[model samples]
Target: METTIYHYALCVSLTLMLFFSYRFFFGRLPDSELYRPYRQSRRLMGVALLELSANYMVHFFITPRAVCPTIAILMNLCTYWLSVWLFGSAMMLLLDREWVSRRRFVRHIVGWVAYCLITLVLWFLLPSRVSLTALPIVLAIVFMAYAVRVARKVFLTFRRTIRRLDDYYSDDGAAYIRWMSVFTYWAVFFGAGQGVFTFVPDRYVFVWIISAIPFYTYLYESYSNYLLLYEKATDILDKSNDADAADEEQQTAQNPSQSVADNVNCELNARPQLVMSHDQEVALERGIKEWIDKEGYTVGGLNIADVARATTTNRTYLSAYINTHYQMTFREWVNMLRLDYAKRLMRDNPELPVAEVARQAGYLSLSYFTKTFKDAEGVTPGKWCR
Candidate 1:
């Protein structure tokens, strides 16, 4: 009875903490075509859900003998580490294209193999030697510190990228931001899991209770990700369906089998023109294109001030012009220019390699170019070029 009560209270507390964590630090989804990545990333959410559900089954349904709880704990720890490493690899591959560079990818794979070998050796050598000792506690602290470092870097990088997008790109930026948060939460929660066991000492039940925090965290986040993804997808589907219905209505008004694109154009013609400014903004747009097309200056070296100087405008005005005229932030506008140029190069000069085209198009790094291109074009540079 006492054990049951203790477990119940622990579960309650853990649930409350998770609820607040999400409330305070959760990410929002975007409301536009940019949410396509978020829709695609539902695969990750599905995998995570499966893993979390499996964990619960192991803990609750398969109650092993208490005679070897220590061994069971060690096995659990090793398996958890393996799972974390795998999940981290997936995130690095999906979130950051550069992570899969030839050298880094090989190194990561080798490192995982080594970790597995070491884990196997340790299991045979000291299978049940794990204890609530000073060493474990110290290691836990180190792991937590590593987690903090990783989390800081991930959060800052994500924030900077998102901030570079203007209002038009905010939806896509929001989706990436959500993904970053999900990955960051995974890192911090698991890293902190080691610390929980350290402090809980010989109280096996308490160790399990503390460990449940990360489990719950993963479960809730994965569930939320799936829900948001489905919601966004459904919203898009409904809008597309409404557009089809309107097109059908127009077709009926005219001749049967009239095209939807024609009806869309008809409807679009009725919309009011967006007001334009006759200021430094229009000049800046012309300057950016002229400089890129004529001078062949690479985008990596170009900044707001540089473009402003080329257009004989101030940085503030150039930035505002990009936002107002192009419906893009400075970074988005630049990327759009580069992507457009890349597409042209690809289509015109099919003989050139994608990387060479990227270079010629003013992209600094082919990896970054590929990622940005895929983000914009919905396909790899090679595929799109083909």
Candidate 2:
């Protein structure tokens, strides 16, 4: 009895902490499309939290193992399913594109929640033998089917979103997407823990609730950090979809001569796929090389737009030119340039602080620099310098 009381107390405390932390930190973000989804996310999360608190409170009144074992297990299982369903639905809205209406999408989510609630309530009110035997079978079928669908959606959507973020920007967009990926896997792990509660002894419930604190705290942190840059992410999503092929026409590039007779050897098959002239390519190649020679990649927060301005071209041309000539995305090209430069800087100025080395190498985040360096060279920057 005391263990159960303690478990609910911890749950309420954890939920309140997660609930208030986001509001305190990101409460002032002005309303926008991305924020609307995040707000909807928060709303559904609030409902889940309320359900958790209430369900835990109910455990104080009746022990599932002792009396009406079927209804009790039904109650516990329903609470777990509601939490997962609500949270999954929240993530769906949070990752939405502007191509759809948020208001309508949210209505659909809430309606789904209502449907799940009704189904679970019906199961709870069923006879004991049926609830015991049928619930597990039904849940197993539903879980298997739902898991497959979720795997496909996450793979496709995340691949597109991450690809678009990579193709468009050289910032935290993919980082945000990667964190969401982690949270999704974490949700799977969290949901799986419920199986233990459904089948095992009750004392282990405390262990699962303890795990919930950090797992959902990460969820809250990622959502808040995402809101910090959700506009950039949403901009990329709004402009493209997974099914759409990239347009070859240069929308942002300055008007350049279309004469293809100049004969520049970029050697990319995708070269002919674009509208760029040979002369324009020649000028861009020369200008981009000069920019690199001048250490333009060393600029803090360097992005494709900055490179576009420096080369007197535009983003579309710069991106395509890099993709064609270098055979890497702009971010990869810049990172390679910066990493090579940082190694040279380390060789020449071994006394430089690792942080200074990272700063001079165009990495705004030292941790990001260290990780990238280690991933590339098999050693930390400092260790590599030594």
Error at 173, model 1, angstroms: 4.6
Over 314-386, each residue of candidate 2 has an lDDT whose tens digit, in order, gives: 5666777788788887777888899999999999999999999998898888988998899899999988877
How many angstroms is residue 383 displaced in model 1 relative to the true structure, after the best TM-score fit? 54
Badly placed stretches (over 4 Å) of model 1 are 1-65, 68-73, 86-110, 123-153, 166-179, 182-187, 198-386
Which window of 10 residues has the lowest lDDT sum in candidate 2? 261-270
| lDDT of residue 199 for candidate 2 | 55
Q: Give the TM-score (vs. native) of candidate 2.
A: 0.70
TM-score of every model? 0.41, 0.70
How many residue pairs clash in model 2? 0
